[model samples]
Target chain A: MAGEREQPAEPLTLRRVAASHAAARVVVSASFEVAAGEIVGLAGPNGCGKSTLLRTVAGLHPCERGEVVLPRSRTPAGVARVALVPQGYAQSFWPWASLRSGIALAASGSGRGWYRSAAARAQSLRAELALDLDLGLRPYQCSGGMLQQAALLRALAAFASGPEVLLADEPFSALDVDVARRARAALRRFVRERGVRALVVLHDVESLVETCDRVLVIDGKPWSTDGASEGVSTARMVLNARLGSRRPDGDADAAAPTTSSFGDAMARVLGAGPHP
Target chain B: MTKGSAGRLALAAATFAAGLALWLALARSGWIGRTLLADPIDVARALAGAFDPAAPPGARVLVHAEATLVRALAGWVIALLVGMGCGVALGARAWAYVLGEPLFELARAVPPILAFPLLLVAFDFGEPAYVGTIVLGCVPIVAITVARGRLGASRERSELLAVFGVPRSVRALTAIMEVMPSCFLAARLALSTSLVIAVVTEMVFTPRSGIALGALAKEAQMSFETDVYFAVVVVVGLFGYAANVVLRAVERRLGLERSTST
Candidate 1:
């Protein structure tokens, strides 16, 4: 249920949100709810509409049949209600706009009168996210992983002051192991401290099991008829795991099971091919 | 200068010298008729005489240059506004592109100068006709280049703005900024075309008043003042080169020197 604008944060609910590309329906009435302060991981097979589903929730993709009833906004008029960290990190920024400009643009809308200017708003977001990087650097000048972090920063900057949700698609795919670990902590702290919800489509079972408060397996069916639904309901929407959120010590890795022992059931949901 | 640039400069100077020598030889041999070609020295003297304050008012090339610049720039501004606006619109909408692309292509296929007669009929013989001619010549090229630039913009950036709910004004500004390189190219091409079309129209129809470079060329050719004709040719060439240099400097200022179509 959506909380009142001035009330405490409530869950972001998707009521039969369906999306199609051309004639083929990629998502078939996929319904789910993500409670505030929770980090939910979405797992599905490769070529499935996992990314598309995230886009649908973020209001990027067109929802054809149903509505994505967004949570009541406590955010001021200028802030984004929902933000998405889309795939393709490197191309997320134009050659002209710097890392700071990208964030500043999104934050500028939300800053209202709270900040001095767009650049100032961007600076505040960097401080809030605990990210340290040169905001002056262009996307082409930065490494792929750095671009991913920058992309994430710009995403969060939109809803930083307002009550909103973040939908990310494999944000860690570009980061190295060491960077990914730190990113997990920062994300955990942001979600917990802000009491906001985030739904991320994870690439691996380890990340799904360790970082998320809960995991939901969306449909694994690929669009066959060029976005027209074969009208099949073969997907068994499963809540496969109820793993707790990141550990307070910031070493959620120790509490998580190894990839081999996490069981094939979870692996299959994460699109890691069936266990032998 | 760097080795590459120095070498390029040397080669260009040598090529120019060789062309001048060949022209002198052709004139001396009387192979080309005197009415059609002037001696290189005579043309240079006439060119220098244009800058000489003591020269006749008719020989003052600055007045002609000013008219050409004004007419060309006026046309260029109109083309810039119309082309960029249309290009951005067509670029954003696929259906618009589908409907507009064919018309743009058809319009582009016809030489812009060919529209001079139509414009003459529509607007009558005046500065308006000449400006309309230049717009017809260059606007399609600008629109097409900018549309391609819009299409080539970083998709992720576009999506980022869309999802982040950046205001439409912010997004439009971003879109326009992304197409700067292409716009620069279109502007450059349009600048030259505008100059050429302005002169050509002036040549075709002598303005009732005001000095015009094209009219000067036509008058010199009619009177068989081949030296004056060649001097005007040289002046036009210099104008084109100077415009290019200024554009390059502006590109450097904006950090866009590495690309013209990126």
Candidate 2:
């Protein structure tokens, strides 16, 4: 009941996953599943270990207990490849590289088949998403929204090289309403088209319910529990939004519940007393 | 030039003029004796004489500058490369950083100029000592700063690189790119310090049969030829300033001039 243990299609799986930061056990035994074609939303209060969980699944951080069971069967590289778009876009990007070069860097693969195709794919994604951007500018030259867009572009470019599990940490929090809508649309289209999964962290509950197929709510111990032992995660899959059968064009139409209904559901889950 | 640049230039001119006025007042009032502070006009004449072409070649500022530049540049360039190489190598692994830190600290404990006497004894008070001292003075800073550059990059950026699985060569290049600001700082510090160290080396060792700028200043000062001493000082300052200008221009061309340090 903790996860879809019966399903074996090999979507990104974290079984008994525990992650920590700077010696403080943050994710205390988190178990969840992100199935193919799923745009799973991770929602939680601040310091609830959402980012740490994403980072651990992406193979960027160390896992204390339990294993992250990455799907290698469906990947182009015959191994799990994850692209993490972290919260700090500016710091992750190579300050010295131009936007075009940064995208190209992400597009690169070990072998020749999918390496350095960022320009073409970026052009196509840009057109599909209706994004207006200049690839010649550096990260510092771009605004916050622009940089976030660039970070998204880089992750997607990496995804193009193979079937990548997209782990984005508040990837579009800085974008304006219009851009955010279009970007979400493009992300949904990409996941559905390629049958890949994405685990996107979102602080906005409305966006979480309206966009994600399933929402995983992260809950954790109080900050004072520094020595909280090996029991790592307290995350749960609480909501299945009637938000989509989700639209690929940012519309809240198909099988969509009322805005008030979705808001109440999110409120109930978020306002729940505490994870026992 | 832009308005800001023009304003800066005007301010620099005003400051220079003020310094000249203060120097003239001090000389006239005999507060700082002429033996200690040469008359500006006399210093200008001495400078002109050093470059007059009619003057003996041995006294020519060009000859001394050329000799010192070659010696100092040889050591500086070598040290820069060595430092960068060490930094890149050590920065690639945390264990390497831990292992190399002690050596870097030891190198830092002794300033490069202080090594001159040891080098002087080792090289029998010759040209090799100056070269050796200049290299010693600069390597530790360049290496330590370059090594630390890799550590300062945000984890998000590093995760991107890792997820993409960029080639080893690209990773090396990224390592280099992350540290450009530190590299520039290292370069600027090394360039400015090497010249001063070179001057000190010459004054202490006084090349037996060659043109050494610091030796000329030392000889002038010992004999109370304040004008000539000031002239050499001006030339040494000019050399340091020009090197900085050249370095700044290179960094600007690379578009790394405003890059943030680690």
- List native contact recovery per candidate, as a fraction of 1: 0.52, 0.48
Q: Is the docking of candidate 2 incorrect, acceptable, medium or high quality?
A: acceptable
In the predicted model 2, the residue pairs found to clash are: A27-A232, A28-A232, A28-A233, A29-A232, A29-A233, A30-A233, A92-B157, B112-B137
Candidate 2 segments exceeding 4 Å error: A1-10, A73-76, A110-116, A159-163, A222-276, B1-33, B39-44, B52-54, B89-113
TM-scores of the candidates in the order shown: 0.78, 0.82
Q: Candidate 2, overall lDDT?
A: 0.72
Error of 2 at B62 (Å): 1.9
Score candidate 1 by lDDT.
0.71
lDDT of 1 by residue, B1-262 (tens): 6797688779978988999899999988888988988999998888777689887766777668778778888999999889988888878767878888888888878887888878787876667888898888888888987887777777667777777766787788776777787888888888888888898988988776658889999998989999888878887887887887788668655655543222
**Among all candidates shown, the one with the greatest DockQ:** 2
Q: Candidate 1 regions off by >4 Å? A: A1-9, A76-80, A113-132, A159-163, A222-233, A236-239, A244-265, A268-276, B1-44, B118-124, B150-155, B178-181, B218-227, B245-262
Return the interface RMSD of the candidates, in order shown, one decimal each.
3.5, 2.7
For model 2 the local lDDT of residue A17 reads 74
lDDT over C-alpha atoms for residue B111 of model 1: 81
**Winning model by lDDT:** 2
